[model samples]
Target chain A: MTELEKYIHGYFGVPTDDLAKIVTFFKPVSLKKGEYFLKAGQLSDRLGFVQSGIVREYVEANDKEVTKWISTKGYFVVDLASFVFHQPARWNFQAFTDAELYVIDQKNYQRIGQMVDRWHELEKLFIAKCFTVLEERVLTHLSMTAEERYQQLFAFNKELFNQVPLQYLASMLGMTPETLSRLRKKSF
Target chain B: MTELEKYIHGYFGVPTDDLAKIVTFFKPVSLKKGEYFLKAGQLSDRLGFVQSGIVREYVEANDKEVTKWISTKGYFVVDLASFVFHQPARWNFQAFTDAELYVIDQKNYQRIGQMVDRWHELEKLFIAKCFTVLEERVLTHLSMTAEERYQQLFAFNKELFNQVPLQYLASMLGMTPETLSRLRKKSF
Candidate 1:
């Protein structure tokens, strides 16, 4: 099975025959490093699941870019509000490195319901999972000190420290780059 | 139609018969002022839709209480993560006033899917709406200044300023009580 198929199967637990049908709706797409999958102000008509490499989602606020997330292999990338509600996108999603993705457009995404008996249940679970992840992030921001945030991120994805830019990571953690540098040194 | 039924009909756009079926699952419940709907460390087995008065969702962080939300009539109240995942609750949901709610336990919530053909679609939209609201909150917290946050909240729900405690509003806006006080003075 492809990585995208594995991820969908693992996350949704669709039967193999049904999973195969769902997988066909997603087409393989690639992005060169620094290329955008979607830009701010555009409607996010498609959702992409990363098969390899990293994608960064960020928004410009107060003339500075704030990183919202760094999605890597096996993670899905989309401006969810735009994708679901047809709103103008608020975040720009760009390839941090050359990336491969399995993408399903909005039309195809909706069509899955007709083909799969339990698609609504699976889709609800998928959205709920996304909501839970977001809630955890909000809790961390509200409760954690800058140092604690840095330590938690480090423990969760140490590889990101080496692979992604420090400023982006700092922004994602809601800390100044200088503070992140200080935390890194203190940790060592 | 009851307020809860109206809210369900408006939110989900379910047919009259189907809406009636959905409404039957939620029983009327009331809490006296200062009583808790749910507390930290308990599983959130039920979700409530506020019919009257207010409910507060807050968590103690580093010995300080951080207010996550002040839910009013026409709003749903639950530690969503705990309710959805069967995890121990993180926030304490207490009645900010003598509140009436239409509540559905997990078992009944699950049964709605079997009873209503389009229940899953309606449910997905409900969760998606929740996620979008959360995304907007995260964006404001990350991007807006304290004054800007206060101003936005005031414009959105001016009545809350008089109805809820200042300290709770301060915490909810991610500012100290002093900062909130200063902003209130400045606004006048």
Candidate 2:
């Protein structure tokens, strides 16, 4: 099975025949390091699942870039509002490293219903997963201290510290680089 | 048409026949003020659409309750993570006032597919709307000042200021009651 198939099965466990049909909607694509899958102000046209490498999502606020997330393999990346509503994108999606992705265009995404009988159930399950992830983020931000947030992310992906810029992680964690540096030292 | 039907039509624009079929899944339910729709640590077994009145969602932390949101008329209420994933609910949902609601248990919610062939499309549109709303909230929290958030909410629903306790609003806005008070005074 392809990595994309593996991800879909692991994430949603769609039946094998249905999985075979669903996989056809996605087309493989790649980006060099620092290239963008999407930029702010453009309408999002596709949703990409990361097969390898890193993608950074961020937004500009008062002349400063605020990192929303740095997604690695086994993640889907898109400015969801833009993709669904056809609104101008608010977040920039860029490759932090040379990345391989499986992309589904807007047209094919809309065609999922025609291809499968239980597509709504699948879509609801997919979206519910997204909502749960967002809910957890909100909970963590509201309940956890900055130190706890930093520690949780570090524990989840230690490689992020070595591979990506600390400033980006700091912004994503809603802390300053100085505070993150202090926490890093304290952890040691 | 009832307020709930009007909302479903206005929001999703599902066909007349499909709308009738979809509405069957929801059964009318009412709650007295201060009654919980779902409590923390319980499984969220149903999703509710409010026809009227207010519902407050909150979480307990360090012996303090932090308000997450105050849902008013024409809004859907649930612990989203629990409803979708069958996970333990993270927030407690309670009626802040005598509330008229239309609720769909998970079994009925999942049964929509057998009722309508296009149910997936309608459901996807519905979920995409939820995701976009969540995205907007995240953007507002990250980008807007606390005072700006207060002003925005006040402008959108001034009645909430008088009907709900200020401390719950303060918690939802991620500010101390003292800070919220200061901002309110400054605004006036």
Model 1: runs farther than 4 Å from truth? none
lDDT of 1 by residue, A71-187 (tens): 999898988789878999988999999999999999999899898988888888888888878877777766677899899999999999999989889988888899899999998
Interface DockQ per candidate: 0.63, 0.55
The window of 10 residues in a row where model 2 chain B has the poorest summed lDDT is B134-143
Please tell me what DockQ candidate 2 reaches: 0.55
B53 in model 2: Cα distance from truth in Å?
1.8
True contacts kept of 1: 0.49
lDDT of 2 by residue, A92-161 (tens): 9999999999999999987876777666677778887887777667667666778999999999999999
Each candidate: what lDDT? 0.89, 0.85
**RMSD vs true structure, all candidates:** 1.6, 2.1
- For candidate 2, the per-residue lDDT at B152 reads 86
Q: CA shift at B175, candidate 2, in angstroms? A: 1.7
Q: After superposition, how far is residue A170 of candidate 1 from its true place, in Å?
A: 1.3
Error of 2 at A17 (Å): 3.2
Candidate 1: what lDDT? 0.89
Q: What's the CA error at residue B65 for candidate 1, in Å?
A: 2.1
